[model samples]
Target: MNQLPQEYYQRLEEIQAIDFVLVELTLYLDTHPDDYQAIQQFNQYAQYSQQLKQAFETKFGPLQQYGNSFSDAKWSWGTTPWPWQI
Candidate 1:
């Protein structure tokens, strides 16, 4: 398998960062539900992460899950591409 492109790896990193923030905020918010800043940060990170996911999927393939037809019109799940340099 080939390694992922620089752009793909960079976006993945960003997605991971946002996910981390979202998880942390959710944990904190469970105890401090009244924390507006944390809530806002969570929302912001979530949206950013989704946007990145959509962009990556649009160009590459499904980031997760199956049956998505954004990249290929055929059976995308079985044909899921590997993230590596060819």
Candidate 2:
């Protein structure tokens, strides 16, 4: 298999980091639903996550399946590397 670019890992790491933050915020909000600050932060992170995923998918491929990602005319399932591949 061909080696992937450094940017791929970088973007993936960023997404993971944002996702972690989102998860933590979600848990906090579950118990503290009145915290408007936390809610705002969660929304910001969620938007950023979507943007990052879209950019990553445009260059690499879909990060998920089951209608979560966009696809071209040809099938991309077998073309892109899986998360565990790298």
Candidate 3:
């Protein structure tokens, strides 16, 4: 397989960062459910994370297995190196 570009790693990192924020917000909101600002932030991050994942999947193949992601003519999941494998 060809070497993955720098942008691939950058985008993955962005997704990871957003996911981290979402997890933290989830924990915080669990205790302080009345914090409207935290709830809003969590929703925003969740949406953004989905968008990022979609774009990444479109360019680099599925980020998940099973029916969670779509496949083209060929299954790229097993063909390409996984995110951590790179």
lDDT (Cα atoms) of all candidates against the true structure? 0.74, 0.92, 0.90
Question: What lDDT score goes with residue 58 in model 2?
Answer: 88
Give the per-residue lDDT of model 2 (tens digit) for 52-74.
Answer: 99999888888989899888677
Candidates sorted on lDDT, descending? 2, 3, 1
Worst 10 residues of 2 by lDDT: 72-81
RMSD of each: 3.4, 0.9, 1.3
Candidate 3 global Cα RMSD: 1.3
Runs in model 1 with CA error above 4 Å? Answer: 66-71, 78-86
Q: Deviation in angstroms for 57 in model 1?
A: 0.5
Candidate 1: clashing pairs of residues = 2-84, 2-85
lDDT of 1 by residue, 26-69 (tens): 99999999989888888888888889889877766777764433
On TM-score, the leading prediction is 2
- Candidate 3, 6-75: lDDT as tens digits: 9988999999999999999999999999999999999999999999999998998888888988897887
